[model samples]
Target: MEATSGMPRPELLQVADAVAREKGIDRDEVLGAMEQAIQKAGRSRYGHEHDIRAHIDRKTGEIKLARFIEVTDDIENDFTQMSLEQARIRDENINLGEFLIDPLPPIDFGRIAAQTAKQVIVQKVRDAERERQFEEYKDRTDEVINGVVKRVEFGNVLVDIGRAEAILRREELIPRETVRQGDRVRALILDVRREQRGPQIFLSRTHPTFMAKLFAQEVPEIYDGIIEIKSVARDPGSRAKISVLSSDSSIDPVGACVGMRGSRVQAVVAELQGEKIDIIQWSEDPATFVVNALAPAEVTKVVLDEETNRIEVVVPDDQLSLAIGRRGQNVRLASQLTGWDIDILTEEDESERRQEEARKRAEMFIKALDVDEVIAHLLVAEGFTSIEEVGYVPLAELAEIEGFEEEIAEELRNRARTFLSEEAERLQKRREELKVADDLVEFNGLSLAVVVRLGENDVKTLEDFADLASDELIEYIGDADNMTMDQANDLIMEARRKLGWFEGLEDETDETSEDAVEGEEA
Candidate 1:
């Protein structure tokens, strides 16, 4: 057999260099791909069953093609492996793990072989380009990128961001923003994922962080760290709200974000395709922050429920519609900005609710303590909401109310305790009649009312309760009870513990089976 020349192919090395530079890949990888093409052609000339391998010199692009037969102690496949005794016959120093190399002659370039080689080289170069793109874009998530619109297909914009392409889906684009081909587009890199086809870089123009970054670029105070963006919410091409806080006491964060004569905000708005921007001052106090978030509408007062993170904002009658915005946009953005649920109310509505609550509290005190309306009204007016407060509050606190002495306070407290004791007895009887599970009754933080409601919902057994999700429990009880998802999870977990539903019995079963097998073996 004739041997191929071992001389360096300088033209081949030059081609490898050019392809590597064009594809933004390593030159050695390209040379390795070329060697693979040559090795495939060599295999066609030699036997296909032989263990053929290929390598290319990195500096000179000289291809070496050979067939390898590995020496083994117990040879199973003769095509790739040879026994140690057989290998020793060829070379006395041959080891069991070493390979016996056999050089093969190069192949003549046929039409089909050259086409197959070209295809292999092209595929390898394409794979390298994809790997390069994935590595380059995966770290760029959550960053702003500028690209040109390459084309539009089915409302999805394909952008050419210099080296690689990114996709901006229709839903990710700002509303009503026309992106024509060749137009410069700026968007936030929402995600970079390596899929089966290649790397997919998802871009978004409507994400809240995009607006925040735009402000960071536009406002010197924000960019310099004098002002920080606390939160941002957008209605896309319509309106957006950004809450900013100033670290320096003298700098007005809202004014700084707005810039001189609205220049800074207008630039962001123009980029967003005429999206109206509301620059709000941020506050640690959620109520104050919410008031600022719902701009162009005045709030009369704010009542915050710290336990549930809800804020009730009362505005004048005329400002109600404005506070809620068109279709509740104002209140919705305010809720998002402050990270709290907001309930907007008119001043008259709030006044009516207060009066009704006061009446109910006065009535409750009158019935529980056997007091007249005047005395009950006095207790209710002093912020005593329930018999529990009357029974547990210090005697001095009750006496501090107008027209109340120590003797009267002591009598009221005694009556409140008696009433609560009777109520507990009644509830205990009701629970017994309902056949509430003993385990549920004993579960800490599971109130009597909750157990009764659970019974009514057919969740009578611990097993039944354990089968329920947190939201299911909330649905059975009610959100008015102020039951949080965490509390519901705790209650359900307690029920599960009582039922031994998560005792890892399956794991124990596996261990027991293994032990049985070992005992038999012994």
Candidate 2:
């Protein structure tokens, strides 16, 4: 094993071996990097325009240096390409795509060339190290990793995790938790992304998943799959709630998470800087889950609007403040844990609201049905909430009520229908006054009041309504205004039908029209 100069340069192989061992990279990679460095130096010394290249023989540790020019029919770069006619003068057998190599005398190790070579090797090694780090940590995302704080920069902590350094951004740290150099930190690997500078390994101690993982570590039942963590909501360094379920009926999920004398939860709480933790039993029923999530605060009742995933929780007046917690944190965490939007109300407030609703219904019945207050009260008490229901209910059902005969039931039903028709005519006149488009008025799922409101909001055309998302439509007409997101979605879809955006709609219509024509002919 000797150099191309017939001199012993065994140091090259030894250096490659040492770099490969120390950097945990391939020996061939180091050798190839060295060749590139030598080639760069050769280009600098001979001429920058020459196509200089260097290759090292793997077994012999020998370096070969040469300048190469490609034989081409039409030469574009004179330094690296030659016309066939010009190449034929140099070699009669020259052909296109063949490299014409001229071996050069060995390069002397000049001070400047040595420095340039060192820089190239350093850059290549760094690139290899970055690639290795990315491969190592990319698969470890979502798992907790421990590291020592190497430095702090403008509040962001750079942690040294063995061979790699990961960044814990300022916001990723738990609120008010200060970290200093050399401190041992444990965090979830939230993201591992490759960027222009290098692969960025992002760590977070404040993520909800971090708290979930900590519980998993502390609870054996969770780790063994007997108990499962359903969801976690964290107000880092303040409080948190976790919902857990048990596969076995005998096992209490919440009790298991709490452990004997509250030891398990306290271990997690300590790790999270004494953040108060509430462990609740998970239920498939959304209302029940909401009830369980708002623990330590007595809830009188929970009414869930499944269409909106919103729950109205009525608590005892004394428990209202506690249920809502300081600045609404308890309700907020409960909402997050149950994945439901929550609205808290005191029992007294609930009773008042119920009374007000009943009063409105009674007045509406009295006015629309042309009935006495006693009869309207009877109708309202019987749970007939709207004119449409009274108009549509079976005559037998209405007559069966006390003090109601067939004649009275029939008259009430007729009055309900007449009132609905008059209301429709009024709304239609108002709709026209607002300049609502006829196409939008004909769209299914949008009521007359909704159409009038759309006109007021400048969403008068089918195109305008089609452009709105379900959420946008809900925002326009208020979420609590007798319209669900599903209904809004249906309206938008019907509006799109007018634009022929649905592929099968036209075909179905055509088929139905042809069937109707066939029936008429028969």
C-alpha RMSD by candidate, in order: 5.0, 7.9
Collision count of model 2: 0
Model 1: runs farther than 4 Å from truth? Answer: 1-5, 453-458, 469-486, 503-522
Query: Tens-digit lDDT track for model 2 on 118-191?
Result: 99999998888889889999999889989999999999999998889999999998889998999999999999
Q: CA shift at 176, candidate 1, in angstroms?
A: 1.5
Cand. 2 TM to true fold: 0.89
Q: TM-scores of the models, in the given order?
A: 0.91, 0.89
Q: Which candidate is the best by TM-score?
A: 1
lDDT of each: 0.87, 0.89
Task: Itemize residue pairs with steric clashes in candidate 1.
Answer: none
